[model samples]
Target chain A: MDIDQILDSVSPIHKDPKAILKSYIKEVNFPKGHLLLHAQKCEKSIYFIKKGIVRAYSNTAENEVTFWFGKEGDAVISMKSYIANQPSYENIEVLEHSCFYEMNHTELQKLYNEHIEIANWGRKFAENELLKTEERLISRQFRTASERYNELLKNHPHLIKRVQLSHIASYLGITQVSLSRIRAAKN
Target chain B: MDIDQILDSVSPIHKDPKAILKSYIKEVNFPKGHLLLHAQKCEKSIYFIKKGIVRAYSNTAENEVTFWFGKEGDAVISMKSYIANQPSYENIEVLEHSCFYEMNHTELQKLYNEHIEIANWGRKFAENELLKTEERLISRQFRTASERYNELLKNHPHLIKRVQLSHIASYLGITQVSLSRIRAAKN
Candidate 1:
């Protein structure tokens, strides 16, 4: 996405492109398999993807669960740890060669302090993140593996293409074999 | 539980106390049993409690789960719906007589746009909420029912005394009798 698109995602109603683009938000490029963030490290920044894909996942004794993924025009971060300035439980990795604009925690705060419209934009975006997390929690509670798989596909079709079957299976709280069986049954 | 304390929570380093006090926020009172916010209503306000207890919960045909509880210094709202401007799945109710400073979603924006520090404060608080939800999700997936119950008791012991047993049961994903048995065993 272009700078305009990024700015729009930020504050559609209020626009001051020049002021929002300066300082902390600098663009960075990554290759596939790049680990943009590490698990258990304090989150220092949040990223906005200009192109390509990023995934948030973690390894367990058994498997990896894809908790979140972002493509173009999306924000990516270890948000929990980022906000707390504590160690993260999840990692952010590039699924494809990607370009992102990075905003350090402090710079973002300074920007918000400097510009009310920008701060409002940040607040709304955080709200969106909160809603997403809430929905994930409820879905995990109420939906079955197959149902979850379908919902995931419905909401994030791109994730199906970018994510591995094993990761997808864990996210659905099922085994890889069950996911395959469900796929077979569906077809 | 005072306004400044709540304001300080969001802005630790540089806070504009009076600016936060403005921004369409109004001080109000809620009696026990008051429904501060209802599901499916379009509300713009979130409450920063000065006194008393409030609950955030959702009812299923089968049960009700306590998603969150708020007391003095906590912000209370139908959070998911509040952000999305959609029908809420959860309800916010006063569990005890309470006092709060409230502002509509628009007022929240007004504060953020006019006061960057307040906006950052909002982001931090929202991030805290997201972290709580994420941890709860992970716990639901990984922790045993007994473990979760222990956590609730440890973190919010007052909830055990204040909330209904059935709601607690639902939150723990167990039956009322089971909760009763557990409580009896513990006592």
Candidate 2:
């Protein structure tokens, strides 16, 4: 989806569409396996994905834990780092060659201050993110591995084909062995 | 904090503080153990706590998981239900005799439409909530039980005295026996 479609999808930008587009600096192509964000760095910008897939993960003492994935038409921001202005605990990695539009934090804040419509769009975006993150957190806390896997299958079947099983396992807060057993049981 | 103070604490409200106050219906003197919200019910309103503590928990197949706690001067809502307009997966139970100011969702949305300052406040509020929730989710995902216990003790020392250990254990995603051992190790 284009910027106009995305802006309207969240909340309509009734005024100053040009200003919004200008604020987003176009990034045409980022290679696969690239790190858009690194652990311990503050996120200076939010990226709107035009194509490809991205994953967010953190390196624990033992290994990496994949927590989230973003696809086309999704906005990718490290909420803690971006909003709190702190070092991020997670890294955002591109899983496939990607194209993006980037908005610097200060520029976005400036737009929010200048335009009520932009501020409303931001409010809706944050509300949507909060809802999604809360749902994911609850699932991690409450659902069994198989239940989570089944729900993922029903909701995002494409992920099974696109994302690695190990990353998916980490996202579900299960070990690879448990995920394998669950997959076996499913068949 | 009163409504005015809360409003200014988040973002400055230059226009129509009275309307905002009118939108928030004052609710007072709720006794301990009162439930502000129940699992499976739609959250029609958001509550700003004036006094006391509140806990959000969900009952899973095995037992209850206490995921979050709110204190004085905090705004409490089931973000998933409130933002998505869905049935809540968590129950918000008051842990102490509490007083709150409530704002119905529709009224707040109306205010957001009419007032840019209100929209800015809402945006700031959502940003803060997202930052906090993201932090908590990361801790849950990556921290060891003992590390979580230690961090909780260092950050929220009053909680050790004000809240039950059982709820704290559940929040840490550990069994009560393990919590006891962690406490034993600490002392």
Q: Top model by DockQ, which number?
A: 2
| Complex DockQ per candidate | 0.57, 0.69
Model 1: clashing residue pairs?
Answer: A116-B113, B40-B88, B44-B104, B44-B105
Q: C-alpha displacement of A123 in model 1, angstroms?
A: 2.4
Question: Would candidate 1 be rated incorrect, acceptable, medium or high by CAPRI criteria?
Answer: medium
In the range B67-177, model 1's lDDT, one tens digit per residue, is 666777777776765677787777888998889988777666556555556667777777777877788888776566788889988988886798887777877777789
Report how far residue A5 has shifted in candidate 1, in Å. 0.9
- Tens digits of per-residue lDDT, candidate 1, A106-173, equal 77766766766676777777778788788878877656688888998898897798788987777776
Native contacts conserved, per model: 0.69, 0.70
Model 1 scores a TM of 0.84
lDDT of 2 by residue, B29-135 (tens): 68889989888998888888887889999897778999988887788887766677888878989998888988788778787777777788889899888877777
Give each model's whole-structure lDDT.
0.76, 0.82
lDDT of 2 at A92: 92
Name model 1 segments beyond 4 Å from true: A13-24, A59-64, A177-181, A184-187, B12-27, B61-63, B177-187
What is the CA-based DockQ of model 1?
0.57
